[model samples]
Target: MTDVENVAEDVSLEGFNPFDPATQQCPHQYYAKMRETTPVFQVPGTDIYMVTRHDLVVPILRDTATFSSNFSTAGMSPDKELVEKMKEIMAEGWPPVPTMLTIDPPHHTRFRGTVATYFTPKTMATLREPVTEIVNRLIDELPADGEVFDAVTQLNVPVPIEAIATVLNVPVDMMADFKRWSDDFIAPIGSNPSDERRLEALRGTVEFQHYFAEQLERRRVEPIGDLMSDLVQSRIEADPGDAEKGLDVDDEGKRELTMSEMLSIVSQLLVAGNETTTKALTEGVRLLAEHPDTWAKLRADPAGYAPTVVEEVLRLSTPTQGMFRVVTADTEIDGVPVPKGARLVVMFAAANRDPEVFPDPDAFDPDREGLMKKHLAFGKGIHFCLGAPLSRLEMTIVFEQLGRRLESITLADDNEFMYFPSFMLRGLTGLNVSITRAA
Candidate 1:
């Protein structure tokens, strides 16, 4: 048996499955135990390793050279059947392309650099009025008092989709379609998805590819002031060329983004920008309802405390739970030997709650001291979320509007929080709340 296999035999995983429904609803208890006993554990039935401790996770994320994010399935069983199946399904979609999120350095830098300026704090700040407007408008459409509604459906999902759609320059009416496509695209990627689900995701991928390819063509012809136009028209020098040399001096030295490249990045933004923010908003509202004091404090001073509440919400209920990194070479994580090419799962959610980092880790304390942006909700290192500023803006504006508009809100007794059938994505499938208007 391999060293990893030997190590797995001695460790007691205790039936931990992040994809299980029970675990999704409440994984912190499991995370705490894993942190205590097996910080760098080999998952029982798989060759994948789970890095449960904060200290170990940070180094893995920071040192991308050693731990590559080329793709989650890098070190998977190289069975021909599975390989052929993946290719057959993926062929239905856009041609194979790599975005900033799924690639390592050099290539990652080039892709991310193409549009990083658009996501900068300064650039994102310019959209405050629009974001706030979108929030107020959604709140305006809320049900009258005595009528309850699902927060995830009415508020949480719509708000972020609309905001991101505007950035993508897509029609607001298409937000519903965007949500549907987003769900379908990510469904197959969830933990142990069945063949049927993979086909469904395949359909979504093909449809999305065709739709966005047309958008790229249009933007290339007539440049617009939106992100799509900016991306397609972006020109950066090729590797062998220096900035001192003209970007367009030679074909080898420079290139505009290809159709596949454009599709990859824009589609990535739609998926990443929509799902996590939607989940975060759902949990933020639920957390407030669970802890009335936090809600009361936010309603009392929306401006002063909304930011802190967002941070606390992010820490307590991180939307994207963890990410997989493939080990480039044989390495030791917190002293555990992880063989070369071994895939490691960085438990960002677990790290966020590490006792070493935050006191009373599991407690939802917005007022906790030293709470000045110290969480891995947006991840760390070079791959840190680019749309974080926009997400924060959306949530802050959302909470501020909720405070001003709703007199009171409480989760319905029958409301059983169901998470998406995903090990990576942490979010409520439903969140019904009884709300009152501020009359």
Candidate 2:
């Protein structure tokens, strides 16, 4: 079939509103249409451009000079009333600043360097034992055989929260609060949240800032050799010599992170550290239950199949659906004109399913060879996820444990899969499944 004939008849981009919750639920149809017809699409009546194709997204991610990561420069402001109210609440805490995801190049380089050593493979290797212990403990608390339970709550949620807590040297007892604060931090992203929801999110943000600010202070006075202690003591060196090379490293001089900067980075780690993994884990369970044949293979050799399963889950689920990038100057993508200050929503989820990149992209094939590393799920270029090692460790352990402990897995009778309403994130609100223990 020709490319035009290959397109689905029902797929129409007319009045496409990605922010709509319905569109957020099952966007594959629209994504396919975008990839085929208009790889670079502008949302109707908005300055936002959606970059859907895999080929197009990589260059945008690499060209930090043209497509900036500093979203504050995008000039997109929130509701005036909501902004005013949030300001009042946020004023009580340390002011928010762009630390990791929001800044580009030299600023990003220095900020990421401070905490980069903590998430290195060598560091993650030391965490395997403790993380495995946490996984087994959570698995031990699962419901009896043939009982229905929410995998998200029982397993997916706690595994990462507790693992990150262990890494940060915080009390695992406060995991419930940690999860809540993480949710609150990303509450307003990718949606037109109600005034009430926005205010609530602001209050929760202040609460988180206050709570972590104390922990950061404690680390300063009493160095405990934890991640927080490292953050408190880490310093960046001045490199004026590199400025002429377009490195932008000399502006801030040599310094430790400001209290506000530390809080911002910690908030990101708390949210990114757990939220993405939780979504991916929940989706993995759902996929295994839906595709029992794949689960059966995993059951046969849990450890052997786990690494691929992790990659497949990350690709298919793509917890972070897309991210915003502000255009630094007027540019054209694939011959289409894009104006300066226009925001680009680089669709990682859509790009993962680009048929050109992954043959039969929709299939849940764990054994799919060679393409595992090609998915942009962990992202591309300089802003690639820092917590990838830890996430992979947690997920690999969970799948292995699930395969070893469960004889059968299936969706609950009344279960209706529902994702959280956000364009930039894709995660099931809950996943209810009935399972039989391995004999």
Candidate 3:
């Protein structure tokens, strides 16, 4: 299909506006409607064409040129205000933008490559012993006091953050703050951020950025065993010494990542990489608790079922609800005309649950055979998550240990799940549960 031939015949047609929570709280029903009728309809409200079909979403996610991701939103406008909003989400004084996640190639290529060296799957695998050791020790420390604690507070919360913190060289005493900062940074509210959650998260972001700036300075003065130090040496600029606060010189003496970019990338990794995996573990246990038959199956063979559980959870409950893209020019997406500057929000969670794609989509079936790997939870193409393998490893170990720790598990009386209020993330603040060890 040619690019010009792709746009819908009528540009005036209105699309189903998905940004509204009414559309968000239950997006699947609406997606089904869109895919079934006028799959490429334009929305006068948003000035963008909605792409609901999985087939279309897969390609849109892959094509960065035709569909730019420089501006990230939930199918909203690619307006600078939205980009600025994304920056503010990271931390204030954060350069009116963060790092490579939202930028296009050339800049994104340079920035992403600098961070990739440290996060490769092989590098992550080498740490399994250490990660497993940490998991074992944490479970071993589980209260013998009969408190019947919150698994989230007890297990889910600590593992991933601790692992990444160990990488960042964050101090032990600051671990709680690390969790809090991640929470507040992404949370709709923030006691941890202080003030009215908005201002609080903003302030936390500034301090967070400032800390990385200082860390970058130290790394420049002395080489260290960390990604930050490695980033300090990339070939971004003609001279490493000439690298300024916001942009840096790479090993090749070209523009790589700056100090500000470093903070944004690190902060994004902390929140996105850590929280998603942690929630998957926490929710994995919750699902197991709800279905003992499944939990029993996992306990008996952690290697086999743990992986499927991750996929199942990802399909059923994606950590990221949607990812936005910018239309390069007037383009037809799934037969809809998206003008230049329009934002295309691809709803991963909804697409995963689309009845056309998954049979009985809501059912929690671990053996959800057939095309299961096609799920869009990790996203697609170059933007596919780098932490995927490590995330799989972490969950595998988690369930293996949880199987050994609890004799039996069930949701606590309260059922008080502090679900995040942000449109971007769908994890809870905490989920308390009761447990007993197997004899």
Candidate 4:
């Protein structure tokens, strides 16, 4: 404890397992407790420090130099033998996936740049028509009596995944396989007694790698007019004569985007970019249902679109529950010394709802003109999400169309609002609503 004032009330580790299933399914109460009782706390036996407050957390994520983005695997202690056995079963399908979720600095910047060019707001706008077409076609199928449908399973989930896959030139028929693999990766599987569920995700990952490899190889020969092709063709090659500058590459005539680099790009986008946005729409629709007045206001305006919905939805339910960082060098965070290499997790989900930051934090008010109206759904600074523009574009188009087309909507079932069970992501599982005629 490097000579700090006692402004923060000391918090006990007590019996909090942030990753526990119960905590994940419904983290609002847990987040509220963390916000009030102990904003900054350390879990017992785990070296990870949990920063729960919005104010304290904002700077931690923004100042990446002091706090690192690395994590320790001291907590996930599943039987190794089981992981191995499943690996063997899922052989050839378990190729390692190198994603940007677990990285820092220079390399992160370089990789983000290559993919970012394709998803810039301008570039993303080109996608609106096609995406809207897809949405309309999907909605057109909705019955006139305002038939009940699981928003997640039917429209919200498929839209982005399909859009991304289409852009990548992945076969439409393969969307099912892609979706199944995504589920295996993100959906919780705690009962895997032998970490077999994780093994399955591993298998899916490996298969994904193999698929990308083949796709890259195909792009090498038959160049498709798409982002994937652009990536494979991208060359951050050696700045010639600067012997120390160039990165080693194979015979593929490429540099920077090694197999690892590609894995990092594709895996993160497919998983993080996919699930986060998808979960967001699910949350958005559910919130609108819960708050009919808000829904009615939007349905009338139509222009409020997905942009307004996205902002309000993110404010209401942050998709990224927490972002982890590690202290690289001796630096002070919130005026407290964080020893070198200490892992810190900035809880943005909790922070977004901070009463100090947003008045009536619990309530949904889209038009609340906060100066930082953007929110941290995509984070801030250099490490900000690359796919954000595309995400916003897609979601906005989806919601605007839904808002305009959705005449009447009601709950399909009274099943409790289901949320993705995890510390990192938050969204309802199945937001089934029958839509037509009524606002």
Best-matching candidate per lDDT: 2
lDDT measured at residue 326 in model 1 versus the true structure, 0 to 100? 85
Alpha-carbon lDDT, every model: 0.80, 0.87, 0.67, 0.68
Candidate 2 lDDT tens digits, 268-319: 8899899999999999988888888989899999999988899998998899
Residue 309 deviation, candidate 3, in Å? 1.7
Per-residue CA lDDT of model 4 for 1-439, tens digit only, reads 1001122234333687777766666566656667787677666666567787777876777676677555543235567677577658556643443345566666466667677777776777778888889888877876666566687888888788877876676787787777776776564422222365676666676777788778877877888877778777776534354344456554553465666567557766777556788888887777777778877777887765456767877766778777777778876644456667766777777787777787767677777775235477777767777777877877788878877877655777655775655677677778778877544
Instruction: List ranges where model 1 is wrong by over 4 Å.
Output: 1-12, 72-89, 239-252
> In candidate 2, residue 12 scores what lDDT?
88
Residue 317 in model 2: shift from native, Å?
A: 0.6
Prediction 4 global C-alpha lDDT: 0.68
Per-residue lDDT tens digits of candidate 3, residues 1-439? 1100122323322444444443344444555566667565465654555666777888888889988878743422234664466566654465635456687766677667877865777787777887888898888877764456777777887888777776676665677777777865665411112235555656677767777688777988996868778877665534334556444454566675556667777887778657888777776777788888888887787667777777887776677766767888887775556688876767676577666777766667888776456788888888887667667677777887777666777777787555554445666667677777766
RMSD in Å for model 2: 4.2
TM-score against truth, every candidate: 0.91, 0.94, 0.82, 0.87
Worst 10 residues of 4 by lDDT: 1-10
- Worst lDDT window (10 residues) for model 3? 1-10
Candidate 2: worst-modelled 10 consecutive residues by lDDT: 1-10
Candidate 1 local lDDT, 1-439, one digit each (tens): 2100111223345766666665556666667778888888787786688887888888889999899998755222335666677678778766857768899888888889887887888877888888898988888888887677999989999988998987888999988789988987677553556666666666777788888888888988998877888888786556564445443435556667767778889878898889999999998888887788888888888888899898888887788888889888998888889899887889888898888998778778888766545789899999999888889999999988887777888888787677776667778888888888787
Q: lDDT at 281 for candidate 3?
A: 75
lDDT of 3 at 371: 41
Clashes of 1: 0
